[model samples]
Target chain A: MLPLIHRFIDQAADQNPHHPAFIFQERSLSYGDLVLQANRLANVLIDLGVRPLDRVGIYLTKSMEIPVAIYGILKAGAAYVPIDPSAPLDRVDYMIRDCGITHLVSSPVRKRALHQLLERDTGLKAIVGVDRELLETDPLTCLSWEEVLQADSEDPPVKVTDQDLAYIMYTSGSTGHPKGMMHTHASGASYAHYSAMTYGVGPADRLGNHSHLHFDMSTFEFLTGPSRGATTIIIPNEAMLFPTRLADLVQNEKLTFWYSVPLALIQMLALEDIGNRDWSSLRWILFGGEPFPPKYLRLLMDMLPGARFSNVYGPAEVNQCTYFHVTRESVQGDQPVPLGRVWEGAESRILNGEGQPVRPGEPGELLIRSSTMMQGYWGKPDLTEKSIHIEEPLPGFTKRFYRTGDLVSIDEKGLLAFHGRKDRQVKIRGYRIELDELENIASAFDEVQEAAVVVAEQAGGDKELVAVLLLKEGRNLDSAEARKRFADHLSAYAVPKRIYFPATLPRTSSGKIDRRQLAQEYAETA
Target chain B: MEITKMPDKSQIESEIQTHFQGEGIELERDEDLFSSGQVDSMALMQAVAHLEATYGLKIPPGDLVPENFRTVEVMADYVIQRR
Candidate 1:
């Protein structure tokens, strides 16, 4: 068993030193060059006092250097915490402080952002800018990217076991705080090994990676691509936003495997005229993160007749447990695509409120047991216990299951159909959002006495977040200003589409905010 | 079918509104549909499909830039040019 994911790249480098490992922005890095750069960075990390299981932050935009930084952290026996460079400085500061991160790897353009974060007393010790430019007037301790690359091209001697942590990915928590999901090397490796096999990835395949590094799905490109000795093409951020450009990239890069949120596919299909383009090189198209609009899925199928589509379903906590391959028979009916069966080495159970297994054709909360399951939420034992449960031995086995909080029904054919979420968690354009987090951020505003956020369904069946705010007596609030304030703390997707200043908020019998009532009223009026 | 003349701005706006089923309000000719949240990615796709079918215009991938679809006036101009 591989103790760390970097070893896979090491083996690949040894086998095919001249093969292209990463293709980004029209530049290619061979396996040998990648490994040597990673090794040099690892030595630099060791010299910078990164120890076993220590958390290092990677706060850079999408580029070839991202893989180098991730593998370097892994080789140094430290888990990499990926922070979106575009995220608000306050949010970045919170993550750095929350995870006790002392060292950060970033690009030169983000030096000012790092300085702003350091001004908040985040205790960030050192910065490793991935560019050669030196900040002469910077107050924080910083190292140039060239200095790290100049270090010895020898792997650092770090004792990392399978049980050691690999990464800590942060997601929105129900209580408005960001929670880190901890994954050990074993868990990550399990996901990488299984997903690669499932996709039939090989050295000849060029995988398309469009997801940001902060997202969990990017792990497929970061870990699985190297493990399978395949090439990864990092889709530029601009291409990700513009679907037509992304489609052009698919043809230009000759990507064999593509994985991203369904929204990207839908956008590409909508914005791009691929009817005349030659997409013969494309083979597999896998999508998840949110439900794909069935109508658009059919259109996408029509566009890419040669590609095989798979609807993958899994939360960040459980990696990927179930997948349904899109077939003519599956897409023929009025029903949306069913989330197929569990992948190898993973088991799923649907249980009712009483923890009793739901019979076939019944709906219940989905629970997952898998080797790829996250270790736990970092530093939150209460939340960890609430999410994961350990059951007593049944016959000869003790089972540990993670509650998915998603309501699903397994049909008589053993195909799982997603019903809806069982909680306030919602997905907006592929990002998992907790409504409570948005409400908490809204209420934090000085002019707002209370806040409630609800998802409103439009005529087209797309859900939009609407925020209802109650102002304090004698306080004035501007909606645009409030939105700008909210943008400072939350992601742009989490910002409410419409803001309403209600005279008084509706309440439930127990005096809690009545979200359902608010949603209904808003829908009726707006 | 050949279109003898470019559609009026109001005609284009009404068609867009009908396509979106009146989800937005107080639409301006130059208002940005995306930034104003009048249309999301899904709605944008639906609008594009609707335009292609209704007007018999094939929008090439390169013309899908935001400048061409940012406003009703720009979209109408794009449709006229394509026609």
Candidate 2:
């Protein structure tokens, strides 16, 4: 049993030396090559003073070098902080200083971004995997990939326990500050083991990784896929924007398991003529981060009868706790596929505002205590303590349950159903309403492709709900009829006061609907 | 009678460069604009607005994919063909 996350790759390399661990474009990195190359990188990092539990930043695009940098940092007994190469230099500097990342692993392809970062006073010590041209500052050192690979292929002399910090994932906070979520080797390994066991992943499975390196979903490919010695085919960034190209990649790679947000799969279904393509190679489709529009999901289910769909439900704080297997029959209706029971090694509770359990079938905040949960928000003790509820059920042992901030309830079938977010609830003219509820009801209309509900500030600093909708091509809506339709399901105060049509809805980097952007747009226009 | 000159690829490239210049970003002719995280949906919208206003070509929702605007070169070619 591999209790250490880094040991997963070692065991895989021992079992399947020739097996491909990661494939990008036409290049492939075999399991043996991954271990050997990672060893060299570990030695270079150790030489560069990357101590145990120290944070090392990985600043590179979606490429083969990612897995190598990840395992290498782990082997050095250091936590790898994956910095988005495309992020602005200011954010990069903040993360580097926030986590005390003195060293970064990157490639020459990012020299332009690296050069700008070096121009700033970031207090960085050394940069690896790039040329000396990146060493703009006097104190900064650079080691090219050639120089790093010149080191001996031997494991670093490091012993890491399961409780050691393995990685720190930074998420944009609502307050405009970024919070890093620290995960230990125990949490990472537990999630990888539980997910692999639940999904019955084996060496025969070929996982298609669609999530960005900074996104939480990348864990399946980096940790879970390697634990079972399965191959991961990385869909490059170029392929993601083009659905037709993505369809070609799925067929050419023969990926057995596909995982991403619903928006990605929705694009492939809508833009690309995927009806002519064969999706027979796929066995599982896992979607999370946001709810899938049920209308498009129904079409995808019909198109890919060979695949089984699972609605993965969890916050970035917990990685993932529950997976609801979707069926062709379930998506036939407009209702979303329910969030299924919690997977093994996880426990959940539905609690109300007073920290008491809600009555069965009543909406409440979903709280989860799992081995797959994060340690806490990095360096934000107050925020960390606020997000979790500690219960000393036993004499000394305490169980921590993370408050998901999401509202949910158990159905008659004992399956969890998601409601709108608690923070998304707002009071308009002293009437409290959930914006997500209004958006959901409006989007359920056949002519509506997508809809977003936002709160716009009024002339006298009052707030009103505004609905920005994207209608299907050639579809028109009568505002009076639409408002009447909304009135059928929602209260008069809860209904949006105005509706605006847009050519397209703006999406964030991870492809979630940008509600904050919509709210600001309407606020300014109003 | 004033005759409007047909917009060429270089002219379109300059327009794209000027669009990014307003945002303080140095536009690369061949680098991926979208995946590089430099051009987000909002940023791409500005470029689309420029293309429509300058080239007088409507970019339908179907043709608004990244394949047509992956880079400055790609977006220029798209404008030339559409114009």
Candidate 3:
């Protein structure tokens, strides 16, 4: 059986107790110290009655405490559900209740928000505040960070198996509510093993953690580093906004492995003169989440002559299934970078509408079969059945394949190139956004009789969400008020940039909302 | 190289509006472009490239903070100061 992810940390700590494990905000924690903290937090979790496979919500920002909470929850034999602390209160409440989360680890700064969320009568039983003083007025049983740290620093000997869930990452769903992707210890361990081997990450490498806890890329950034005994550097949120500052951090931290969405790298390249910076320590630069423009990719290759680049692709449901190494010859073309070959231990197939594998050079949906594939969406059996299909009965065993909904084609060179999405899903800056989700939220408003959302490509090739709302007869809605209402229901990226109240929304012959017509109309008018 | 006059606030706003072309949404001078979902990471990169080419101002990595590009007014101020 595969060992739990925390076992890697334990092994590293035992071997190199004094080696730096993580560096955050100028503070460094050695492997021994980090594991002790995690062990103590695990004892705290056990004392709170957390059992194996139980879901615990992690609602803290990207900080030193995040790694501790994550490893602690894993050590306690419970699956950690990361709730983006910046998410709306209603969304957070929905996830907490949906996942049946019994314990939550958050910072004290969110005390008011947590209290308000708990008022909704979620299944949350205990709240562990990291660095906030517990008050009598707190709605739930709150434990201070100091108290949790005082627990015995011994590993909790919970009977955790490889099949046990390690984490549940929630992503945007087409049906308005976010769906939690369930990943097991086996799947996560496979990813860690393959990733460490593919990227050549080792103890000498300093891996940069740029992605948020809620994002799938963070799995590779956080877990693979520990798996290889590498030092993980958590880039502060504020540093991300300033490309120059982020570059300085990379230089100062001596990051050897850097991974993030292509958008962030593009921003850094545009704002910073990386050609002049000391990037000798930067070895592997990995990007995914969206397609990178060829021009920018070429420029990036030219700028970083010493670094090797890889275009990694996969959904949250399957972590890092395929990777395309950017070669000097590959970057010469005007075409977008190829999705490349499937990663080791993962199977891929391009099937047409009839579910048969398509011929080479024919566009079809990509299906993935791998140990790293998510077990299923949490409490969403119907969605799970629809998204994952079991192959027809074979002699030995049936194979389950996940329909990725991504349209791709294998070129003559045997490289898979992305065409487009087969569904209404769109990615904006590495965030998987479902257009119907925005439409559903808009339709929920009282004044909105009908709503349609479309992705509009700006002059700079950036996709922006545009909403067309048809109000009920004799009723009106203010755009500002609508935007304010959207903030309460969705994340900032999900909010449409422009809201239009048209007299009637165009429909197709089948009476479905015609998004193409709406897009053309909006474009013509603008 | 000859020094040229820096663009005004309205000109920069006009250029940004033309670049983004948000159908009918009017951007305020002090509006937070990022939080408002108007300026994403890619859009910000495009805006930086456009500003450099249009205004002939070298926007170093240090000048790419929120304070410099949070709004057209601030962006124009940054350009004028650099010029």
Candidate 4:
């Protein structure tokens, strides 16, 4: 049988039964306990009428239960779909209805949101890890964590191959609705294998999980960390909001591996007093999703001299494909490090808009044909077709490449140099934001007649979103209401920081909202 | 908004209420405001500025932990403890 994704954790449990599998708030779940809990939960899911290949939603904040839910779903031969616990109810409902997720594994921490979600007409058959009281309101099944912990620990009977679906991660699309990127066991296993081998993580390694459960960055900590018998330390969401607290977590956890977005490190550098901290245990640091600004990258390197750093690169469509290790000699002053070469098990091609190969050093879209590539966007075949390019190099043999949408070039050092996105999708705080999605959200509001969003370069060199709205006559929205509205639809980091009410927005000759002109105006004002 | 002393718990609570009032955010006292998108970084910093301005206490960034700033009651408690 091909190596299944959850088999990694199962094998680890067999080898290192007493080793810490996951850690939170100083509490450790041994591999033995983790396996049992996952088995029990898998049995509970199976009892809840979950069939093989069914999608289970994980609506949770960062917690130890996340790993349990993930492993349990995979053990039951089901695809786990992680939904952002903080997402708007409509968006959450959209994912559930769109993907036909019948069972959701969530913690009590999401009780408030889950209650609100229950009020919506979601066709969920069961919500695991919730209070029994919810049954009074919703007739569907609600199993408490106590039951999952106490249920039968015998492994459930299942037959799953690597080709079976494993998970679907949803991200904002340029279109109004969010899109789920589907990954099978084969893809997830490939990613875990490549990242674990690339970083050389092992049984003794302690991994700091800095990303949210829904974000693709968590793949490493969730899969690779346990696959290698490393103990994963989940960083609480509360700590993430406070940079000093996050620095405290890194020190207290003594995590050997730290993988997160560059924004996290930059915030710590800006807000924390690193001189007095004991973050000496960290040996490897990987940052991805967005470019790591050189000035802050240099500062982080100087501070964490004992740790090796890598600028991890790739889109969620294809799991992390490249890593640029940082050394004093590799990165010059304010010169960004190259994206490095693609790792084993993955190949890439740089093609221009005309779908032809670009010159060696010319910039073009990065297309990746990797074992880690997602199957496609869930329920959106047209979108999947649009996002990927296929070639028939050999008769009766076809090759598929996911278009990264990231513009890159081969630098003088023969490494990939990343330019910005090929489209209006700009990243803020490592979260992808399709500018048009923000506009669509604003336009949907009753007050907004038209809206436009622009990424403004702030004085400190950070990017801030500035939104201009042409409101309906006599209707107005202040920053607070706009914030609530936008935050209700998008992630916290994706909310536009600045709002402007113009009597009328600029327009092009074709009567389109001239975002270019608005962007220019904001740039001038900044 | 100048005061000679740290405000009482009620006063601190009222100030926090006023800060988030314009944003139309209503939450349980102990609910997680930060992660739920109810409180953005800009809003959090503004609340920090509001508390500092009203109570005349410089909140060191380290004190911005959830215990002190996640909810109105905790924020009030933190401010009340400052005296």
Best by lDDT: 4
Model 2: per-residue Cα lDDT over A1-526, one tens digit each:
4478888888999998999999999999999999999999999999889899999999977788899999999999999998865455656778898888899998877777778877777778999988886555667889999998798789888989999999998865533345699999999999899889988899989999887787789999899999999999988876765677788888889999999877678778876467777778999998877678789888877778778889988887899989889876777777877888888879998999998998878999999999999999888999889999889999999989999888999876778998877787554532335566677778888889998888887665557788888999999886656765664444234446678888899999999889888878787443
Q: How much TM-score does chain B earn in each model?
A: 0.76, 0.87, 0.75, 0.78
User: Individual DockQ of the candidates?
Assistant: 0.06, 0.25, 0.09, 0.38
i-RMS for every candidate (Å) is 9.2, 13.1, 7.5, 3.8
State the DockQ, from 0 to 1, for candidate 3: 0.09
Worst 10 residues of 4 chain A by lDDT: A517-526
The C-alpha lDDT values of all candidates are: 0.82, 0.81, 0.82, 0.84
What does candidate 1's lDDT look like per residue over A1-526, in tens digits?
6547889889899899999999998799999999999999888888888899999999877777899999999999999999966566678888999989998888765655655676688877778863434544344567777788789998888899989999999999888778999999999999998898898989988999988888899999998999988999997655655677777889889999989988777776765356766678989999998877778888878878889999988899988999889987777757778888888869888999998999998899999999999999999999999999677668767788999999999987778989898899999778899998999998889889999999887666677889999999999887767766666776566668678998899999999989999887777333
Expressed as tens digits, the lDDT of each residue in A251-309 for candidate 4 is 88888999888888888888746778888899999988887878788888888888999
Candidate 1 regions exceeding 4 Å error are A130-139, A394-397, A524-526, B1-83
lDDT per residue for candidate 1 within B1-83, as digits (tens), equals 23456777678766665544333223457765543332444446556777898788887767767778877877877776787
Question: For candidate 1, what is the DockQ?
Answer: 0.06
- Ranked by TM-score, the better of candidates 2 and 4 is 4
Q: Model 4 Cα displacement at A342 (Å)?
A: 1.5
Q: Per-residue alpha-carbon lDDT of model 3 for A1-526, expressed as tens digits?
A: 5578889889899889999999998799999999999999899989989999999999876678888998999999999999876567788889988999989988765655665676677877788864334444344577888888899998989998889999999999898889999999998988898888888889999999998889899998678899988999988765666677787788888899889988778877876367667778889999999888888988877777899999999888989788889998887878788999888879888999998989999999999999888999999999999999777567878899899999999877778989999899999778899988888899999999889999876556567788999999999898867876776767666778778998878889999989998887765332
The segments of candidate 2 whose C-alpha lies over 4 angstroms from its true place after superposition are: A424-526, B1-8, B21-25, B32-50, B60-70
